[model samples]
Target: MAYSKLCITLLTVVIFMLAANPDVAVANEATDELQRQIDSLVRRIEELEKRAGQSLNVPPAMAATGAASAGNGALQIGLSGLFAGGGSSVDNDALSRLQGGAHDPNQNGFVVQNVELSIGATVDPYFDAKAHLIFQIDSDGETVVELEEAFFTTRSLPGGLQIKGGQYFTEFGRQNKRHPHSWSFVDQPVVLSRFFGGDGLRGQGARLSWLTPTDWYSELIVGLQNAKGETMTSFLNAPGEEIGGHTLLDRDARRFGDLLYTARWLNGFDLSDTISMNLGVSGLWGPNASGDNTDTRIVGTDWYMKWLPARTQRGFPFVSWHTEVLWRQYEAGDLGIADRETLRDWGMFTQALWGFKPGWVAGLRWEYATADGDTATDPLRDTRKRLSPNLTWYPTEYSKLRLQYSRDWTEHLVDGSADTLWLQVEFGIGSHAAHVF
Candidate 1:
């Protein structure tokens, strides 16, 4: 502190001396040299102060915006939100419960769908971490918070291999790994909801993925997760109830081998300069939590193709088509007066999205499912189908407005047909990572 003051005093003295003795050539030249030295010292002091200010956290926004420089790069922190409100005309509680209950499409009223917060940063030379939190309104119109995803991924691995560990969405099908806000439409496909529940299957586990050295993009992924949670519809190993002097299966009685296991193979092809396509096949198997120690298995196939003209590729007016088909089998012991039985259920959905102009897109989707088994209260027993068409306007990369209409048909269930119209607006306040392709 004393040296800084002394230097300032010396600089002021030289400036005054130079002004008072302008005619003295020798003194003027010496003073000019002194001035240069003083200027350099002042700049060095300013740099020291700037670095000190950073260490002291003088500006909070720098940290909040993830602009603070760290070892290798700036620390990353971000928050985003989605608010959805729309009315439905189906107006039948029973049908709503049958379809999705609280997340049903037939329910009439305004509701908040999702408000998400995401944060992430590199932990060290070996790994990086991220967490996504979600908030929404429950069936009783109460606010609730849910942890959507929290995981750590390996940063430096050899042989084109990567590892991830945490509670995350499994890569079972095309759209299960994505959040609702990132979906092309307002609701998930009917098949996904019926097969994996409203929230796609996710649990605490570790995943390993390897990229093959092939001409076309090829990769394989495998994972093992705890076979529990309400989202595990076909394999919840909890205790069952007693109805009419009969007890359902108990999942806890099974061994650890009953844990859910998943695997997927992905491949991509560049059909031409203006077109590309992706194909994938996935499978999930685990023991059903029912006390009977029965097992469940599910298989899925997905395909996606996109086309863009070479001339407008930058601003990219593009058309894309995606489709997924799923099949599930459940084996169970005697629940009634019968022997062992195997029931099969399957569903498929196809969609197309066209970007006719910049920031404007339109899409159409068709979904169908059926359960070919003998069960009196099987939700998937009847033929269920829905057709939806939607229009969307993206004001920017971080915000969008969408309007959609859907017509649903239930073949065997009573009062099984309905129509619904929806409007949604979504925006983000902070930086967010891009969605998976």
Candidate 2:
């Protein structure tokens, strides 16, 4: 009996000693902390998988992290500022035409390219919403505020279908839907500026997208939007604008055919463990304000490919190529009018980027644009060619510095060509959504 009592007392003493031991307590706490961390990671992975299944493209590296950080039902707010300093061989007025893009830097000195505020959130199980507000300082030193995009997208739908509506960018091409802060180059593509106006094509609209059940990723998108705005450059632009020598009139949408109709079929393929590709064809048809019965049609194709090693660090040491070709047909006047004519124009741009190391990228772009007939004197329709090379360095995921040089060849320029150099800087704060692949 005495031995049994002594054994029990000794065991109790050992238990008390262990409970008081700092190392043991620390070990217990560490185990609990590890469990908590594992739970968090598991939750994040599940959320990411859910998003991947719903999204059209898989985001890379830091972008995925940003999306995950937003968490379910939480709002994400981000602000980004872009600034540029540059000089061009031509005067400011001529440079404006060369730059073409509303967001591009057009003057010889410092310019505030874009300041944007973005807010997004998952509204519920059925919907997600986002908005972007843009602020810029024009050459006249006037502050301009614009509602870039405000849209809602379906979160859950049957049969792999989704709908988006409200004021938004038309998904005419990969680049058209991207914001200025997401562009690889410091400026917008020359072809996009010419066809979609200084601002990329966007308007109040609704779109439906279907994610087909295929071995590889495939999606079909159809959209209907108002056709009469400055953003619809090839269609019913604002009054006083002239296209193909035909003055635009104040035209209203009298029928469903007067609205812009857009369609795109996009496909994605995993060519190999280390490479991926996306190919898409798009079309737009709508009424034009050039004449009472005239119309316009635009078609385009885009191809994108990226090569990464089976292993990557910070999504670095990769190569990507993107190309887009566009053609436009414009009916300039009434069929019975003496000056009636059918005008055709086409343009293409190709660009490649090499991420040689973490946060460092080198890029080159080539562009060519021309139209049928003797349009050499018309800045918008003339034969224009440009070559641009740029280098970018990202100090961190949220800040970057870039320098670019462009050589322009255009028939409308007095010098026949021009050289321009620009240095750009951008910084962002808060959680920004991941860019699409």
Candidate 3:
């Protein structure tokens, strides 16, 4: 009896010990699973932070430390470019204009060509920076390159106001920002030459623009420009100049070396969304455009309209027109000196673009101009006229082919006239922010 009682008591004691420590087994099983989940969460958080840093273009360490450096604040990087080349001809008896030689062809010694590159990025939701570079070569393979523009912009203001700084194109007319590559026509209207002196309108300046929000779009721009324009020293006989023989705008003498101003206003409304029209009026006032101390002032307007219907089963068709009239007021006209100021300058031009296909377009342009400066003695008596027509075909989003015919009339340096006809082949592309023209 004593032995049995002892054995029973021992077994009861063992069972009690096991029951008291039941939580130990459960904790061991749950702890491993919970620990695994915690580790995964930590790794996931680290990856997310890394990606966020990259999106801001911020250095990972800097991001982690929460510092906003200028180089690391960009949100997106943009790239754009163009390449265009074609042949040209004019009548032998017509006035032959020697454009920036890079656009010359062998037949007429005036081929068409263009090459451009641009880089842009948004530093923040409301701030941006842009840079444009150009490389153009004539049919003879002579090259001329330029820095088209470089500017920084910010829009952190009330009523969508934006401030721009650095060298920029004046918003005097449509073509300042109206890139030829983005245009449907192969050539610009004649008015641009009279109003803004074509590409010479580019200037070193600062501009401030305010864009108002609404279905009716509106914007205002003011510019303070360097009246000397593109310096002849940067492009000419100063040595190392690759201008296919000569540069375009600098053929004339220096006009203004200081304070030149330009201002523009834009207003437009949505013509049922698919079709729209905009009107821009601009003015530029400055001194001595011809280096004769004869103050020069010009004013003009630009109109743009687009038409796109909801249904176009037969591809897409649209028409566009650009026109301008300019009257250059000369403070000192009809001076007796041989190289003296002789007359006021005035000219008018209009052009149209028609789309035959999504990427194909046809264009026509015409202009009449009379400048008192052509002949240093009789700047006004000289009348210059141009008539141009062009057709283009695009095989892809990045390529274009164009054909153009034109006539010119100028009674300047030569006699009656000279003209010719030309056929050209052109290739273009937009990639990697660089162009080959």
Candidate 4:
């Protein structure tokens, strides 16, 4: 009888509290609604996974919270800032030739390498879109703004086919499409700077990619873009620019054949449980401004290999090697002209990175470039080589610190060689997409 009276008293107290506090009843109802929504999202995700025959691997809490916030056509915005401070053995004027990349830290003091604003989102069910805008202060303290990339890609296409359009980086090589923040080292490769100019071959274009249904991963990409611009270094670059002793003319794309044509075939394989590799070949063809009838052709091949142990801590303890070789043939003058000749240039860069622990990576790179001529006096075509060693530490996913040293050798420099040391820092905010491997 005493136990029955105690239970009656507790029930009466709960009823009295609920009656006195109306907010508690509303809070309980809201929580139930949120739980229902989470359950619905889980079911939808499971259904999608079943259809795709692969696990999305999304944690339940993430799906219910962060992922849900991005649902229903919400836009994602991100900003990244990269800065560097360093000194070179040579003066700033001479350092410009050695550090050829536009974004590379060329001066002997502090530099704002890149400040990028990235925006991306899904456009309904058929397409996805993204844009990158860059802001930088030049050596002369002039603020410059540029539309780095603005592109849209098809979301779901049949037969593993996809189409991309608008101003985009040409799918020429592994490094061409990567942005400055994604680079393993602070500076661009010497060969790439010479061939693609400091901007790395980007223009208004459209491309089609096909994912082959092979056992091993394989992809074929073809693109067509306007071949006249400063970025099209091997093609119709800016007027007054000299290449191979030939002054570039103001050339415009008058027909489809004048546009740049690009093709690439990339393949990936798993050598073992702990090893993976990617091999690719790329080519470009376009008209040159050296003469009305002159043209340019470029070909390149790239290889990458990575090794990781079975167990990892935050993707630590891995080694990766990357190498690329490129060749270019330029028709310097019109056929039948007295000065007509073909200019042949080739270059290669190989780099290796060791992730010795979580958030720490050490890297070394070697580069070589030359042309088939007496180009000792020409900075662009002269024989050049460089070695760079760098160490990077990532304190968090959104921030990093790096230190690098580069030793450069060139025929055009009076000293024949130079050394450079750089310290770089980077930070990001907002939801940035993961970079491509």
Residues 219-317 of candidate 2: C-alpha lDDT, one tens digit per residue: 999999999899999888999999878899989999999999999999999999999999999999999999888899999999999999977889999
Q: What lDDT tens digits, residue by residue, belong to model 1 across residues 1-437?
A: 32233323433432343245434322223434433433553455345435534665656455334432333344454334343334444444644644452233334443346656666778888999888776655556456668879999999999999999998989886788887777898888878876787777888889999999998999999999888866676676335632122245555525667789999999999999989999999999987744455678999999999998887733559999999999988775645637556768889999999999988889999988888754334454567888999998887776677878888787644566676776665655334455567
lDDT of 4 by residue, 123-174 (tens): 9799999999877767886667788999999989999999999999998879
Q: What is the Å distance of residue 115 in model 3 from its true position?
A: 1.8
Q: Cα lDDT for residue 327, model 1?
A: 95
Tens digit per residue, CA lDDT, model 3, 15-120: 3332343343222243343334324433443465466567668788866554222243542222222322222333322222423222233233332234455556
The local distance difference test score of each candidate is 0.68, 0.82, 0.52, 0.82
| TM-score head-to-head 1 vs 4, winner | 4
Order the numbered candidates by TM-score, best leading. Answer: 2, 4, 1, 3
Off by over 4 Å in 3: 1-112, 138-141, 183-191, 194-198, 212-215, 231-257, 272-274, 289-294, 312-315, 332-342, 372-381, 413-437
In terms of TM-score, which candidate is stronger, 2 or 3?
2
Per-model TM against the reference: 0.79, 0.84, 0.64, 0.84
Candidate 3 clash figure, as a count: 21
Worst 10 residues of 4 by lDDT: 2-11
lDDT comparing candidate 1 with the true structure: 0.68
